[model samples]
Target: MPTKSNNTGGRGGARAGAGRKKSAVKEKSENGNPGGRPLEVLDIPEMEGVEMPKPHDFLSAEQRDGSELQAADIYRETWEWLKRIGCSQKVSSQLLERYAMASARWIQCEEMTSKLGFLSKHPTTQKPIPSPFINIGINYMNQAVRLWNEIFQIVKENCNTEYSDEAPQNDVMERLLRARKGN
Candidate 1:
């Protein structure tokens, strides 16, 4: 007598609709807050009649030229932004100084790379090698990103106001902050 064979036709895999059912989870918005529980909005107190400190107080005299000067400008602009958003009290002057310097250095390195090109000559072998400015720029950019992230962490957790950019379209720092927030 012939035995009855399975109808799978030698197929060993799972059939259609055979896996576990997916849970009906609600999608999160940009803030990553689900609608079930109430989100705790932090109220950062605004500073009243405070004077913005000069960059010379934080940066040494020797570090106040070219890109460093630009860094100083960046620091001032960021301070004003923080003040406007009511989170200036949360971040320290030292942190802003560091962030500015790193950003400036990154830009300086990128400029150098663009001007000098990516290839360089070795000291002894005289072979074409990747420009040192490329790695230096990347390192500076990483530092700037870390510092910016730290600043934004405070702002995101303790500030209820939306991050608004009223600066011109050419504002590099503002653009960078917005990009970081999107991430």
Candidate 2:
């Protein structure tokens, strides 16, 4: 008697309806959209009864003539300059705040420099001693100057202004002073 033949075609062979169905909806495509359609844009909701604070809000009317007010003015001017130079709002806002802080620090340094002279007399030795406060004020002023320079460079580059590390030959204020003196 012949033995019954028993052989499977192959391991994990394809069968009817074994893979994904052709009619099924694609959840996502290679371009990262579902059903081959882009996502919808939504409008931002309007805020009501919320007022934005002014830049100079930190200073009172009486204190508006101080360094804090000057800082706020610098911040506003820097913001406008950055915007005119086509900087993004986020970057402009950040840089404006930084510039304002630097200006304020510079003012503080000026005050410190005025109060603390370059040299101080020794408490009892009757000799001169270098004033540590002056050194600190100088450091702060240097940092502030550096920050201002960097910010100005960025603005110049963005606005495609003539790049020059040297000072201008005829200063406007100097020319005005000469005219006034001659007349």
Candidate 3:
């Protein structure tokens, strides 16, 4: 039998002071960087006479039920938000369109799930199963979130000043609910 040694070299695993460095802005605010160089300032110029673009006609149709029309409205709302935040210049039309489509699909899935209920009968097996809309809704929601994060990252990288929401009264869910109810 070989004797077991207790000594182990510090080759792997996390060490002290490892991983990502804290934000320079946060560090400067907390402890004050006395000798460090000053942080760079970004000056984003305002565009004069900038007009909001109209979404493509495919986004809405009278024949196609509620979701199509709602998607166009959602796209307009999102555009208004970007413009209000002074970050509209950073977002592209394609990216915003993708986000709106994902969100509208998610809402459509949820509405279907509500009507269909959780359980369903398999066509071939004749056995009860979970509704397909549940999984579809989750996927659409995740895609929307991922797109939103990408948009947010663009805004975060470009904006120099701290972004704050002035109107907390206008909640997203409430607006959606009101739209759904036709209130």
The numbered model that scores best in lDDT is 1
- lDDT per residue, candidate 1, 5-66, as tens digits? 87765677877646654221222234465555555554556669887777764443345333
Q: Each model's C-alpha lDDT?
A: 0.68, 0.47, 0.68
Q: Predictions ranked by lDDT, top down?
A: 1, 3, 2
What lDDT tens digits, residue by residue, belong to model 3 across residues 39-103? 54346677866777787776665535544445677778887777887777668888888887777
Candidate 3 yields a Cα-based lDDT of 0.68
Ranked by TM-score, the better of candidates 1 and 3 is 3
**lDDT for model 2:** 0.47
Pick by lDDT: 2 or 3, better one: 3
For candidate 1, the lDDT comes to 0.68
Instruction: Give the Cα RMSD of candidate 2.
Output: 21.6
Given candidate 1, what's the lDDT at residue 42?
Answer: 41
Best by TM-score: 3
Clashes of each: 0, 0, 0
Report the lDDT of model 3 for residue 100.
Answer: 75
TM-score for each model: 0.64, 0.41, 0.68
